[model samples]
Target: METVMNRIVSPQAWKDLADRLGVDEACLKAVAEVESSGGGFMRPPSQLPKVLFEGHVFHRQTQGRFDASHPELSYPHWDRSKYSGSVAGEWKRLDAACALDRGAAFASASWGAFQIMGFNFAMCGFDDIEAFVAAHKQSAEAQLAAFSSFIRRPGLLDALRNKDWKGFAAAYNGLGFAKNSYDTKLATAYLRFGGRSP
Candidate 1:
């Protein structure tokens, strides 16, 4: 898999995503900027996307497959509270989680600038987890494609197209959208990018 350590989308890529989503390019740009600071990579030198691995999700995904006898190969035995919430921590946890179970490991972490959960592979139009990871390794355009797939699955595209920031953010960011002010932030970003704000 090719590691994408830099910004993957060009202006054209954003336009393509907008066209596919049937919304203004600026709205998509706002999402990209707010979700991933305009790209997926966390910073220079790292080819991987910023990720946050949820140990609870890993345990849930692994369930009966976890080998209690060999705690190293089991998600249930893994310490969920040990993460530092940094890039280094993400890599560390990912490496350890992969050692336990590849499928569960990948599914436990949110990927790319959009922070889409790995478990949502099917929702993002992927046939399986491997395909999703492959897409992540491909390019930013691929990442955006996944994002588009995600929003479309939940009918969030209509919200975006209509400039309904609260609706989009509520669905996209979850019920706790107000905690992060995602709706306001997205609206601000949209206006800054020359789009009408809701």
Candidate 2:
């Protein structure tokens, strides 16, 4: 069987990063395991792909072209710039893709192992996947920052600080129906990581 330690890219590196982030090492490691599976191109499918493909997903809306059929808020995945198009076709294609692109069965554009959604990259600071990955690879510090953004950016720390690992995990995973199922595993991992008695 594979050991949990084997999954982690750099444990000491993550420890140092945890020091900088002001969170406990055990907590941070748990968060990392739950968030990015020990870092380096390792994220769950839904979250990461959407972050990575957000640009292409949004481009279907055409920022300056003229088209028909696209409407603001017409589709769940519609770009915020839906109204920026000169015509409706830009909006139409975006709408179609939104309707058809359910759960990444077709797009197949997952870039980073973390599978950060494409839409969030620009607003999150990184310009592209290559830059984000190259800078973060084998570097626990960078991965820590990235995971911090992924978790805390959505108010995850508020939940985590309250011993709400499930809530934090759910938030990190974007699941509205998160439960406390993973709490035991997380707690066990914490004790082990913290040099505490189990």
For all candidates in order, the CA lDDT equals 0.78, 0.45
Q: Tens-digit lDDT track for model 1 on 111-152?
A: 886888899999999999989988876678788889888988
Kindly state the number of residue pairs that clash in model 1.
1
RMSD per model, one decimal: 3.9, 10.5
Give all TM-scores, in the order shown: 0.82, 0.47
Question: Please, what are the lDDT tens digits per residue for candidate 2 over residues 49-142?
Answer: 1112232343343441222343332334534464333223433443454464432312212223344453444433667545554444434345
Candidate with best lDDT: 1
lDDT (Cα) of model 1: 0.78
lDDT of 1 at 148: 83
Q: Worst 10-residue stretch by lDDT in candidate 1?
A: 69-78
Off by over 4 Å in 2: 1-12, 35-115, 136-141, 176-184, 195-198
* Candidate 1 wrong stretches, greater than 4 Å: 1-6, 64-83
